[model samples]
Target chain A: MLTIATGNKAVAAAVKEVRPEVIAAYPITPQTEIVEQIAEYVTSGELDSRYIPVESEHSAMAACIGASITGARTFTATSSHGLAYMHEMVNWAAGARLPIVMANVNRALGPGWNVWAEHTDSFQERDTGWLQVYVSTVQEAYDTALMAFRIAEHKDVLLPVMVNLDGFVLSHSMQSLETVTPGDFVPPLHLPHAIDVTNPAGYGTLTGPDEHFKFRWEIEQAMRKSVRVIADTERDFAERFGRQYGVAEEYRYEDADVVVIAMGTLGKEAEVAVDLLRNEGVKAGSLRVRWLRPFPELDLSGRDIVVIDRDYSFGFGGVLAHSLMAKSRIEPYSVIAGLGGQEVTFDDIAGFVRDRTPGSETWFGVKGNV
Target chain B: MTEIPKEEYILKCTSACAGCPSSLILRYVLKAAGPDTVLVVPACCTSVIQGIYPNTALNVPVYNVAFAAAAACASGMSEAFRKAGKKTSVIVYAGDGGTVDIGIQALSGAFERETDFLYICYDNEAYGNTGMQRSGSTPVGARTTTTPGGKTHAKKDIDAIVAAHNPSYLATACAAYPQDLFKKVGKALSLRGSKFIHVLAPCPPGWRFSSEMTVEMGKLAVKSGIWILYERESGKVTINGPSKAAMIKPVPLEDYLSGQGRFKGISQKAIDALKSQAEQRAKHLQKEAEGIC
Candidate 1:
């Protein structure tokens, strides 16, 4: 069925199709609506699941972890401080190899308490061993969520997945998406390590240094192998749903002298800027990074790259820019923009790409303000 | 009822100290919960007592979670079992540090939401796992590693705090009273919604007492009205066990305080104050129980 829905509703709609056995969540701005919609679905008998209204985000993730260890499909959502609060359990879920799916609304961390779109929140969790997928549209928000289950639960990749969408930009904006019924696309969940009462065994116990290092190495190996698993899952998803996606979504990058690299909604906006530059006799394109973890190594060779980061890592440069420079060995212009949900239009993005110097980091839009 | 079954779910050897009461508590708790139970333990003595990986003393499934997540984790396990249509009892076996202090928020949340599970706070009065340090459950004038001079405030009334939530079953027990502790555990297991069993588990080393005196200290604690025995079930409360007599004719608090080296400080004023406080608290609990009934 096709219908217009907000990004949060789209996530809820996808969760309905996924049919998780348990859903645990706490209300956080820009992420509350996702849980609220799921509650409505559960109440109306649209989804058969136990919705645990946990006290805090930490408990929410902890609850999901407990449920997931039992081989039950679990789901949760949080943003900014909520995600930060769940940091301990976040590592736990990944370490225990539970394929729990969470929707992390990208909001800026606060001293000023702003509930708006920024990548710093999810970006901070880049090394927590979770498979991170950044979505740009409401449809992709729904689609990525559905695909996350298959990717995370794959035998080769039994790791938790976090689907990132911008706080207000994608969470509150309305867009049309095609939905599916349960069991149509996503398969029934099957976890090999599920807790069985009749045949119970201990889980997540203390391990000595002799074996702890081996277990950590195993997680690293699984993360490395997840790349192929994710690709295969997305391919199968496209075959079933007729909608295609990749680790990195390319926009007119072929035969271009310049490419603007970005994530989330800004990645979508950069496509407009790319087209604008192309029409004005500038050979420009955009490369929208879809997933940051298993972080796909794209062939950014022979092009002047311009990286637009919505987050900055203190002492280091922008997260995306650093990752790009490390992987591609390219000194791209790293421009920080749209922080704390600050407005950065296509014109601003085009201006960033137009007057870019290689290897230089620019605090775009903050030049005059600061 | 039927002798409460003599089967021991936990094995003989544990990582617990020589006279740690946790082994006894675990044995009784598991006996009541049965083989089809899942235990969620945080960073407490039970976490270490369960033994190292691939070699646990427990017969049932154990999920050793983070310090502040035992209740929430058990909540998830119960819900998972319910959804999977499996007959499983999820229990949180946490220490006083995880229960009364760091883990209170999670416990309160679980109780408020009425998540179906059993939470047992084995109050050893201090953070025994991380070395003997003062915790919320540590009584006033008792010297701990952190509270070298002695804790300034009285023990936090966790029983009263949890009772405010009005759980399906709530009780306070001690290992010294095996039959009563087992009975409360059995009763809690029979209920459906959130249930709590707070056991005053004494730590010989942490309490600065001889290893052989753990059970005796537990007994003295109740006899002196320091640890009151009570149960709040289905909106009605009742005073239970040895403490019931102490409510009418209070025992000398000196008997309880003098036995432990933690209270070795020579302060007659503090001793009198503690005794008076225990007497007043017991009287208030008895009055509250009468009103509830």
Candidate 2:
């Protein structure tokens, strides 16, 4: 069905189509709409799912782990502080190799207390054995959430997946969404180690030093192999749903002199900036990184790169810029913009490309270049 | 005293300490819950006692979880089982620390939701898995490793806390009385909607007593009315065999406290306080049972 919906509602719609058997929900700002929508669906009999309104985010993830381990498809949604609170169980869901899907509304971590768009929250969980995908549009959020189940439940890639959307920007912004009846797109999860009620088995037992690292290595091995699974799932999804997605969404990069790289909503805005620079006769293009973990292979050998980061790593340079520099062996000018919902227009983005110093990082709107 | 099934769920060998009452409590717990059950355990002695990875010393399936997550996990598992159209019993077997300390919020959450599961807390009075550290459940005047000078705080009333949830069924048991423990488990499982069983698990080594005296120590606790045995069902309280008898003519409090080295250097003031508290609690229960104020 084709209709207009907010990014959060799109995610809830996709979840209803996928029909996860269990959903652990705890409310947090920007992410509350997703759970509320899901709760409404469950209450109205539109969707048949066991919705657990858990007390805290820790219990939310824990409940998902419990249900998922029993071979039931599961999901949950949360924003910044809730994500931080469930950090332990987040690692657990992946370590246990349960294919639980989650939607994370990207928001800033606080002291000044902001509930706006930032990538720091998701980036903080970079090493937790979870596949992360950032979506720019409502359609993309809906589509990615649907595909998350297929990718995570693939036999060779039994890991949890996090679908991230920019807080208040993509999360609350309304856009077109076309829902699908996922009949066989996401097959039933068959966890090899799932508990059988009839047969008595033991789980979460103490692991001696000899076997603990082996289990960790198995997780890494499965993660390394998920790259292929993700491609196959996305390819199959396009064939069935008529919407194409990739590890990185690219725009006009073939004949460009400089390629601007970014993620989330910043990626979409960077495309407008690229068009503005092109109108001004600057050979510019855009590549929005979609997958953060198992960051895909992009051959950026022959292009001058300008990277926009909505997140930072404190003492280190921009995450995307520094990672791209290491991966492609090229120094890209890094521009930090749109943090804590700081405004940055296409005209300003165009100027960033016009006056690009090869290895310099400019924090846009910071006075005196500090 | 129990015509309970002869089948044993716990295997003969595991890494649990000798005369560990928590394991005894679990053995009865599993037997009553049966094979078609999932035991949600936390970071307790039972977690270590379940044997290492790739090998299980249990007949029924166990889902080991983080310290504070046993009840929360059971909440999810019970709902999942209910949704799947399977009649699988979800039980949480945790230590007192997991129940009264770190796990209280999850327990409250699960019970408040009226989840269909049995929450079993084996109260050994201290964090036995972590070298006998003083936990919230540790009684006042007990000397644990962290309470070398003797604990100054009273034991946490975990039973009262769980009862506040208005559980479908609630009971107190001891490893010294296996029949009572087994019967309580069976009774709790017979009915639904968030049941709780708090068993007084006396640890021999932690209390500085001989392993052989474990059962005797539990018996003494009830004889002196230090640990009451009772059941609360449908908002009514009933004092069980040992506790009912102890209330009429109880043994001296010093008999319960003297044998254990943990209470060796305990002050007279602390003992008087413990005795007075026990007396007040028994009187309240007795009055409630007799329909008095």
Candidate 3:
């Protein structure tokens, strides 16, 4: 059924379909609406789940961890400092292979304390073994929420997954979405119960110094398998709901010399900018990265790419650009712009692409700001 | 129903130090926690006694996390079980040095999140794991590796800090009282959300006491009001044990202090000051329990 919904509401409605047994969350700006909607669903009897009202972001993850261990599909949502507060647990969740799903409304980490869109929040947790997927639009938010369960619960890849949506840009932005019923959505993806007290299994048990390396290696292997599972799940979603997203979502990239790669809301803006550039006879295209952690290496090879990094990595210029440079040797220039709620205009993006030089780190819309 | 023999119920293990209060308290904790619990142990003496490769005294699953990551690891384990649909209890078994110092941030994070788990800090005053080093929980005027003559800082008020988080259950116990320790462990296991128990475990090596004097030292510490038995439920303090008889004068601080070589360098004035401080803290706790403070 097609319904008009905000990204947060769409995520909440889609998660309701999963019928998560427990929902524990403490509200932070932008992400608050997701939990608030879920609370309403619980109160209205639309969803039957245990909602744990936590005091802070740390406890929210803690409560989810507790409820999840006791045979429940737990869910939580947070943004910015809340995500930072959950920094330790992120490593824990991934190492334990919890298959827990979270919605991170990507916002900038504070000191100056701004509440707005940025990728730093989720990007910072990239190596924490979470299958991080960035949603470019409201429909993708709903679609990714459904797909997250399948990818996370995959037997070969039993790790937590985070659906990253731009704080106010996508979280508060409304659009049409096609929602599925819980009964129809869950059965095919649901695997046999992994946790049973009767037939006990040891999880997150102590590893001696000798066996610790092997345990982490096993986690890495499982995460590697997620790339295939992510692709498969995206195919399954497309078959079921006629919408697709995962890894890299390419737009007009065929026969293009200059490709702009980005994630989240800026990718949406980049799509518009790409078309504008093309009309002006500038052979430009865009690739929106839906999955950031399993850094879509296959898509980045042999391409003159321009990465729009929304957040800085402090001493280092751009986190995404640095990651790309570290991974496969790609001749890509990073445009460090749109930090702490700063606007990324089309002119700024166009100016960067127009002056694009291969193998150099340049800041777009950063000149004269400092 | 027929009754089993009392002799059969008692453990026949002979490995622990003579009259070790922690050895007895640990037995009760394991009994109450059962085989389904996963324990996270940090760098501490208990971690040493639990032993190096292939000689674990514990029957259930145990993880020897880093000094500062026990709470974080336990939180992770709890989440893992939740995802798998298992009901296993996640317990963090840390020492005073680990809990009161290195692991404080992780502990605070876990408590703030109200993670459903039991965090037990076996407080043996100083760090017994590293040749009796002074920890945050070490009492003022007590001698140790850092405090050669006497400690300058007071024992960190951990119970108050934990209670401030509004945990579901918080209590203090001693290995001398096996039944009390057992009941508190059982109670903590039954409750949901974050629960903390601070057990005063006397170290024969660190306390400069005889191996056989462990339980007696514990009892003396409590009876003299050096360590108070208190519990907090939903952020309200409640004193559990009865106050010592007023007719019987409180023992001199030296009586308790003399047992430990840690306090051997304390001057008469310092001992008197410690005695008064212990009494005042106990009275304050008692008043809080009585709903007057």
Tens-digit lDDT string for candidate 2 (B8-114):
98898888888888888888887787888888998898998889888988888899899888888888888888899988889999999999999999999999999
List each candidate's DockQ score: 0.74, 0.77, 0.22
Ranking by TM-score: 2, 1, 3
lDDT of each: 0.89, 0.90, 0.77
Please provide, for model 2 over A220-286, each residue's C-alpha lDDT reduced to its tens digit, 9 standing for 90 to 100.
Answer: 8998899999899899989998998799999988899999999999899889999988888988999
Candidate 2 CAPRI grade: medium
For B1-293, candidate 3 gives per-residue lDDT tens digits of 22212322113552455665556677778777776776767777656555444455556556665567677556655755655566788888888988999778778877887778999999988888778889999988888988898987788988888888889999999878767777888889899889999999988888888988888888888777787777888756776663343213555556788888888878776777777778777777767777887
Candidates 1 and 2 compared: the better one by lDDT is 2
The full ranking of all candidates by lDDT, starting with the best, is: 2, 1, 3
**Clashing pairs in model 2, backbone N/Cα/C closer than 3 A:** A201-B61
- Which pairs in model 1 have colliding backbones? none
lDDT, candidate 2, at B225: 97
**CAPRI classification of candidate 1:** medium
- CA shift of A279, model 1, Å: 1.1
TM-score of chain B of each: 0.96, 0.98, 0.91
- Candidate 1 lDDT score at position B253: 79
Q: Using Cα atoms with residue i matched to residue i, what is each candidate's TM-score against the true structure?
A: 0.97, 0.98, 0.84
Higher TM-score: candidate 2 or 3? 2
